[model samples]
Target chain A: MKAKIHIMLKNGVLDPQGKAVGHALASLGFDGVNEVRQGKYIEIDLAETDRAKAGGVVDRMCKTLLANTVIENYVIEFE
Target chain B: MKAKIHIMLKNGVLDPQGKAVGHALASLGFDGVNEVRQGKYIEIDLAETDRAKAGGVVDRMCKTLLANTVIENYVIEFE
Candidate 1:
């Protein structure tokens, strides 16, 4: 199975890197670009059989290593 | 309108950060985890009336700020 994990900073977190990129875009003459929020996409290949097991594994992945839960939120999609 | 931009290193690019996270997951006893590749997600709100204009703006954003084209690939979704 293949799972796609998306992790992003919570709405209120301060994202300095994202801000820098937004400033760079505006400087490059791109208009109507209101804001930029940066996040993470992680793809994992798992050999688990049951969907529940897979989700549990991914949840654990998020809680343990895939994300810093203090500042980010994550979602997983499996196929 | 909101667009989600996903950017990832092309296959074959050495992703040390991804590797480090994968190693950490394994060390934490998460099984069936074969590999991991990390990427980026950016959400934007555009006020353009034309979809093409929005796409053009997003393409420019990717080229100029959201992605480093030398080793990465990007896709944009419009809503």
Candidate 2:
């Protein structure tokens, strides 16, 4: 199974990186950009084939390391 | 308009960060992990309302700065 995880800073959390990207975009003449919020996209290829087991492993991975639950939110897509 | 961009390294690129993450997972007892790859997820909120223009701007952003065309590929989702 393959799992894709999208992790982003939680709403209200300070995102300096995002701010910098936004500024950079504006300087590049992308004036339509209002805000840029940056995050992480993680793709994990698993050796296990069991769907439920793979999901469980990925969930645990997110909770333990992939995401800082206090400041970020994560969504997972399985294939 | 909101645009979500997913940026990933081109295949065959060495990803030390991903390897570290995979190692960390293994140490944490997550045995199912096979290979790990990490990338960027950027969400942009735009002032422009026209879908076509928003997409064009985003495409330029990707080609110029958002992604290193030589080593990465980006996919954009519009809303």
Best by DockQ: 2
- How does the DockQ of candidate 2 come out? 0.86
Q: Model 2, B60: alpha-carbon shift in Å?
A: 0.6
Residues A1-79 of candidate 2 have per-residue lDDT tens digits of 8999999999999999999999998888789778899999999999989888888889999999999999999999898
Q: Candidates' lDDT values, in order?
A: 0.85, 0.93
Q: Tell me the lDDT of model 1 at B41.
A: 85
Say which candidate scores most in TM-score.
2
lDDT per residue as tens, model 1, A2-77: 8899998998999887788778877888777777777889998888868888998899889987889999999999
Quote the lDDT for B72 in model 2: 94
Q: Interface RMSD (C-alpha) of each candidate?
A: 1.2, 0.9
Query: B1-79, model 1: which lDDT tens digit per residue?
Result: 7889999999999999889888888889987878788888888877676898788878987887778999999999987
Clashes by residue pair, model 1: none
Local distance difference test, candidate 1: 0.85
As for model 2, its CA RMSD to the true structure in angstroms is 1.0
Off by over 4 Å in 2: none
